[model samples]
Target: MKNFKNKVAAITGAGSGMGRELAIQLAEQGCHLALSDVNESGLAETVRIVKNRNNSVIITNQKLDVADRSAVFQWASQAAKDHGKVNLIFNNAGIAFGSTIEGFEEKDFKRVIDINFWGVVHGTQAFLPYLKTSGEGHVINTSSVFGIIAVPGTSAYNASKFAVRGFTETLRQELDVMKCGVSATSVHPGGIQTAIAKSSQINESLKSLGLDPSHAKDKMAAQFITTPKKAASMILKGVRKNSRRVLIGPDAGFADLMQRIFPGAYQVLVGKLLLRRMR
Candidate 1:
């Protein structure tokens, strides 16, 4: 929406990274916030930051695990009740696991999908009704550059992000067909300086597969070319314009360009990059 003042925005994963930054910025814009995170301390910190902003913003903080579909629905209802109406839902809760498809444990892979892919699904479906009731609404789901291009040891993460991209795109189309004012945008953020890599659970078996887990994490941190604050600002700008897809970094734009130009051939290019990293 062009104006954010007095609007109610609900953000998943509001404890840190882009989510926290979005909450803070929205507060400054006079938007009331419903912030949730599995990390209680981080969520509290986010609430405190938003409340301390110059605007008198309403803040609701809750410990939520987005993977739980029922809980997400419940939270949406509660947030609508607490804030009077919901105009935006940032389905930003996500996690990553480092593993080849062969090296990943079935359970671990499922865990990643539950939080990363299904979490977006849960948040979207849960809040959609409330959004429609608000007359105008937007859903921002976080995908990744990995969603556009697959990497050697991030199968689960790639799968989830790719799914998010597809789902959000389809949701946007459906909203258009239904003539609903609620719109959705899929976000592809190239390596931002977030704890995602450090928080990643690497498959120990990756070493046997000739990939160094420690080195991979290091490479990940090195690739973080954008700050979360910058990413958050870009996201809000995209929301105001109702952008269909928001690409957050130069690297993300480059990857999207390469994917359009090379398509399947880029897999081989990425393979070469992986080998170079191994060396």
Candidate 2:
């Protein structure tokens, strides 16, 4: 919102990466923070950093697993009660499952879907009431460049991010129909340096599949990815502008264009080479 000063903002996955950075940026702008993550230490660290900024706002940190629907709903209710109202909800917690369909494990598959897809569902649905109560609010859901275009070896991740994009788009339309001031925006970040590349669950079958998670991380990190803080600032700009779809990174904007204008060309170009690289 234009008047971020003194407004309350709630974020999921606020322990590290872009989520934590978003909390800091919003706090710097005078927004009160309600930060949640499964990592209690990380959440506390985020709160500590935000408080150190001399923000004239209260910061709350909670250990939350966004995939737990009941917990998300309960905490959302509590957050609204404690903060008075929430003007922004960043449903941004996500995981990466770097597996080809053939090499993917069921456990990792479910974890990716639960955290990346259902987590957004839980966060959006849980916070909507509070968002509505605030009269006007914004929802920022992290999809990925993969959400729009699927390359090889990341089916599970693509599915979850694609679901988030579609879900957030539908909510945006619904908000319009219902004439609610609350709006939803989907995020397509190219490759911000996040732990998902390495810390992500990659099954042991990768060696058999001739894939290396370590190589994946190294290749990704070499992309000279935008910092989490930069991504967070871009996200805040998107929220302020009420963007329908915010694409981050220099590569992401190009990818989005190619996706819309040259989907079939983009497919053939990235696919065969990408599949070969995977193996």
Candidate 3:
């Protein structure tokens, strides 16, 4: 846990953004990587970059949808078989959705939950055995600042992230109770620079809440003050320390503090700030 050298790490969403940066950094530190992403081109690019930078690092990649339980399990098996043993699983694949609860479509809500929440579950369950066999392992699940504080027009995203937070925390506790060498950390990241905004499902429902869906994505992207490389570095640091929760940016730290101070009252401040942004 204190070092990554010779460790085998499986990372989902490794095509770009934080995932790609994590792979690159881990490779630089002498870690072997098993990478996957739904974006085939992006995945290839990540592999290319890792190879170009660290030719000695072993890597295997797959075009994967983390929500697919069988596929994730299969990939886990393959990664362990190929790498000899697996030591880390970064369950980082996620998607964003923006809509009010009243305007949210069931299918869209399900999609966000499936990929953002269930995907983490699948990755953990699939790779857990391999991690246990390795005798030193870590599970990193990506949540968000929204998981700590809710705001308008992001009900689905908030739900999914919140679920991830709860699930990962519980998993971490169970791992501790079992005295397993494996550990888990819930990652609450602020707006780190990533492609999530461009690929988010921002529906017209935001209009019903006096928000403009057309400009929402751009507005969200503008708040991304942290870079993916920095986020990746912080995450790895957390893993080395075996932190129970990791907050990536200043915004994330502020959100966590606000929730601790205001709890139920923070909703009003969040609503006002979001409305001001939309206007």
Candidate 4:
């Protein structure tokens, strides 16, 4: 756990953004990679990048949907078999949705939960046995700043990420109590320059809020304070240090502090921010 060299890492959502950056950075550290993503081309690109960086490092790419429990288990088994052993599982696959409970359909909410919450659960559960057997293992689950503080139009996303935070935190404690070498870290990232917002499923709530979709998108992008590479670096540092929680970006740190100092008032602040965006 202290070093990544020659260690095998299995990453979900390894096609783009932080996941892809994580793979690249880990490759630079001489870590072998097993990467998965629903987007075949993106996964291929990541694979190419990693292999280019370290031709000697083992690299495997699979088209995967983390929401599928059976598929995740099968992939984890196959990955372990292919690589001989696995040391880290980065349960980083997630989706973004923008809608209030009143505006979003039940199915939409369920979809977010399946990929964002259950996906983490599935990844951790599926790979845990292999990780435990590896003797020195780690689990890094990607949450979000929204996980710590609720937002107006992201109820489903908030719910899913909060569940992830709770799940990973409890898993860390359990691992500690069991005296296992495997550890878990929950990551909360603020806006980074990623395609997540562009790819997000936004409900008609934007229309009701009197916000133009394009303008809203621009505003979201403008809020980004970090790059995926930087986020990846911070995340890897956290993993190396066995940090219980990793907060990425200054905004994320600020949000965590604000929540800690004004838990109840934070909701009001978010509401005001939403109202401002509506105008």
TM-score of each: 0.97, 0.94, 0.99, 0.97
Root-mean-square deviation of each candidate, in angstroms? 1.2, 1.8, 0.8, 1.2
lDDT of 1 by residue, 75-129 (tens): 9999999999999999998888987777788999999999999999999999999
Q: Which of the numbered candidates is closest to the native, going by highest lDDT?
A: 3
Q: TM-score winner among the candidates?
A: 3
What is model 4's C-alpha RMSD? 1.2
**Per-residue lDDT of candidate 4, residues 1-279 (tens digit):** 777999999999999999999999999999999999999999999998888888999998899998899999999999999999999999999888877677889998999999999999999999999999999999999999988998777889999999999999999999999887899999999999988987888767766666665566666777787999999999999998999999999989988999999999989997788558555
For model 2, how does the per-residue alpha-carbon lDDT over 25-122 read when each residue is reduced to its tens digit?
88888889889999999888888888899557888777899989999998898899899899889998988767768877688799889999999999
Local distance difference test scores for all models: 0.90, 0.85, 0.94, 0.91
- TM-score (C-alpha, index-matched) for candidate 3: 0.99
Clash pairs, candidate 3, are: none
Q: lDDT score of model 4?
A: 0.91
Alpha-carbon runs more than 4 Å astray in model 2: 204-210, 272-279
- Candidate 3 on 155-196: residue-level lDDT in tens? 888999999999999999999999979999999999999999
* Residue 96 error, candidate 2, Å: 0.8
